[model samples]
Target: MPLKPGANPYKILHLEKGCTDKEIQKAYRAQCLKWHPDKNLDNKEEAERRFIEAKEAFDFLYDKEKREEYDNREERIRMAQEHHSKRMAEADGKRKKLIEDLEKREKEFSNGGKRSADGSTPMTAAQQAKKKKTDQRNFKEEIEAIRRQLEKEVNEEVKQKATLMKTEREKHQKSQEKLTPRLLLKWKTSEGLDYSEDDIRKLFSTFGIISHISSAIEKKDRRKRILEFESGANAWGAELETGNAPMPEITCEWLQPPVETVKKASDEPVKSTNTGANNLEHMSLDDLEAQIMGGF
Candidate 1:
């Protein structure tokens, strides 16, 4: 199935990236059952749409090659977005500083300080208002200019980055999988009450696409919430950015090594161990029966 633009197969299937084939199949089946038209008679249209979406996601991700390409593209896009955000933040800081300096200068002028280098008197209220208006307009213009320049730079860099990624992907087509970073985060408040998943998304959505959020009660009656971002970088970014935010004043920690890795490790085959009967391998049937009965 052809993948829809801007559609994320992992999110559609409710599975994280690097999930095993069996996990994908299980999620697909769950989605199929949940959204089956017969099961959602009252909302058949929406259900059918979701059902088709699930199928498309399954088909696209079931193919190793296609899924790898999709993942690589998503990574490139996320990196570009983070770069752009960082640049814009720097520009905003500079803009704020400029505004502060302007305000300080206006305050100095208002306090009867020399208005000009040539020992000029303080301006009247009318003149001050005019000056303030002009300064504000100039500040706005400067901010707009900075925004345009940053946008241009980001666009050019993103284009170059995409081209570079393509070339690198071709060169390393058969390379081993890279180490996946931790994208799942544990969130909880000091009060031990967790926010709803929708509320959590509203708070952290600006940082990145949230794949899932689950709430649970841990030991000692502590309520815990696990927030999963589609990008590990975004998860880390959210942790850093939310530190000073008044809302969502809760604590967050990246779940180390990611959940998918833990699942995969647990799924590995263990070495076979000898049974208790192996101790009596040398005994005859009658002797083994006698020994087993005695042991019992």
Candidate 2:
């Protein structure tokens, strides 16, 4: 006989039904190792067939929709079998009762007992209706059982797929977090000097792409500009080549951001006891003299 739905896959993988995804994967690997055509030189054809069967089974069970459908079909087949068995039992019981009634009628006729005018016993209308109702109820119950089993299997498959997807997404996100653009070169200029952004870009553009050029020239601070290259190689090349260039006033180095230090709050407040300095404008001439004397 041909294998039923959801039956051959588990057998092919050498696993019990309802095994976890991890177990399925492990079994697949083991099957591949054992039945690989390269390893079975003497029986290449058989090994190749087994390997293909294992792969197909794994593929079917690995997919949620295909697995669920298989499970539902299996459940329906089980329900049908149970219903058939019940029907066979009912038919057998009816046959035995009819045989007993026939034997009893034969004994009565031999004993000269009076028979009914019709001379045959038939099912009453109520009994016939009751039997029909019972059969309908049994059929409905079997269908409902199959439906519930299918639903449960579907829900479990969905949950498993969701968990697998979540794990894969988290792994992808972590890999993305590990990758970032390379750092750019930052050069600090000497105080009391002037350097334009255009001049900086032109100076570094020969080596590689200049992503950004920024200059900060103010009254107190001299010109400080940053040249950001597209890649680290270009930045290193610019650093090595520009060392002997004419521009000696400015220094070129990799710029790193300053680290921030967090200060903890103190419980006690600091006290200042310079009342003379606090009220210097309001102090009188004698007070000023006394303050000056105290300081001496």
* Local accuracy of candidate 2 as per-residue lDDT tens digits, 93-150: 7556655655564444443333446785544556545655665566556656655765
Highest-scoring model, TM-score: 1
Q: Estimate each model's TM-score.
A: 0.44, 0.35
* Candidate 1 TM-score, C-alpha based: 0.44
> Which candidate number would show the highest lDDT if scored against the true structure?
1
Positional deviation of residue 231's Cα in model 2 after best superposition, in angstroms: 41
Give per-residue CA lDDT, model 1, range 186-275, as digits (tens): 334554444566767787788656666654434443344555555332233454434334433555544322212211257852211111
Model 2 gets an lDDT of 0.52
Colliding pairs, model 2: none
Alpha-carbon RMSD, each predicted model: 26.1, 27.1
